[model samples]
Target: MAGVRKRYGGKRALDGFDLTVERGTVHGVLGPNGAGKTTAVRVMTTLLRHDEGLVRVAGHDVRDRGREVRRRIGLLGQHAALDEDLGGRQNLEMFGRLHHLGARRAGVRADELLERFGLMDTGRKAVKLYSGGMRRRLDLAASLITEPEVLFLDEPTTGLDPRGRAEVWGAVRSLVGGGTTVLLTTQYLEEADQLADRISVVDSGRGVAEGTPDELKARIGGDRIDVVLHDADRLADGAHALAHAAGTHAVSTDVDRRLLSAPVADRMTALTETVRALHARGIEARDIALRRPTLDEVFLQLTAARGAGRPGATERQEMPA
Candidate 1:
């Protein structure tokens, strides 16, 4: 997408949104609520047209080559769109027919999908009788009926339990392994970190940050060293020692439990010095670990800067429609 914009009356849903998804890779679209992630997916999937900008899916122009684009792509919307009255197998067969596949081929494909998605035993059961995870898997299977080259998944695992989410993740990994290009829009940070090769964070209808999970985390700052002391009275002492050793105010002390967080530019040196300092003061730490910044931390840092009216605030200027 290039300079994409969409409006619901005067309020813009997407503001000059631009995203580039390379072929055969999982590109994660991440954002907080109402960040235009859904709107962007709709435009890319050709379900909704952008007021401005060029969108190409599978090398077919979304505007000028709607049919070609649709043929090459599959979509699983935020909500499950399944025929409640129809059996799972029947629904798959119906979609396959709509895609113009032969009856025999459609039946075979439906059965294969049922097994692959762990729905084979329940294929004969009505969709309304299926569980939430079953319904989600069925929706995903429906999207793959056409064997699309490009897949658009909008918050695919929203209501799933841990096991169900894992199943979906496995299916996604299999798709990518077979060289399918995926555009995933998810509010779950761990989902993006686990699956996406690159992530683009959107906020308030604009791109705030874009990079691999590690790259974005690195941009925020250095490693975080967290120490948990045995006694609450050692909290202040731990904080002071960590601050003097780390050369930054990146320390947070919890008096109740004697927990301290210190930012370390160099983990090895910081850990060594912190251990020595704690030992010298007879402060016994129950636990200590150096943690890299999480995607959530990176997102908070980047979006916080934007909210603070920092420099490059409008670096991604909204293009005129």
Candidate 2:
């Protein structure tokens, strides 16, 4: 999408947004609530039209060739569209038939999908009886009944437990391995870091930042040194010592937890020097370690900065699920 703009009355859901995703990879779109992640996906999948800008999916323009775009894309939305009374295999077969695959072909396709998603053992079980992960996998399978070239997943693991999320992640990896191009929109930072080959962080209906997980993390700083002290009163001293030791005065401290954190140019050398500095100052630290910055920090810093700078902007609500 290039300079895509979608408006709803006085509100602009997508304001001059731009994104490019490579083929046969998982491209994650992440944002805080109402940042236009879902709106972007809807436009790309042909479910909603943009008032301006260019969008082409699977080599067909969404504006001029909606049918061609729809034919090449599959969408797994945030909600489940399955019939609770029907069995797993029955659900998939029904989807296949809806796509005009005949009885025999639908049955064969259903069985194939069931096996691929590791649902054959429980394919005959009613949908209501399946676990959250099982149900999501079934929903994912249903979307692929026609084997679309590009699949759009809008928070596919929302409200799922860790195990359930992991299950879906594995299934997604398998899909990408089989040459499927996936576009994922998720609020979970770790999900984006784990699953996305590259991520585009959107805010206020525009692309804020885009890169691999490591590249994004590097925006703020590099390795960090965390010093947890035994005494809360020494927090200030610890902070100063760490700033000097790390050769930077940009130290952050937590008084309640007696922790001091700062960015370091060199991991091992800075760690060694900081430890010596604390020892020389008779500061007893409970623990000290060097670690890379996390995606959580990156998300918080980037979104907070954007939110604070934008004026006359009320929080936008996402489209109804």
TM-score leader: 2
| Model 2, global lDDT | 0.91
Per-residue lDDT of 213 in model 2 = 94
Question: Which stretch of 10 consecutive residues in model 2 shows the poorest summed lDDT?
Answer: 309-318
lDDT of each: 0.85, 0.91
Query: Candidate 1, residues 273-304: lDDT per residue as tens digits?
Result: 88888888888899989999888888787776
State every prediction's TM-score relative to the real structure. 0.90, 0.96
TM-score of 2: 0.96
The residue-level lDDT of candidate 2 at 228 comes to 97
Colliding residue pairs in candidate 2 = none
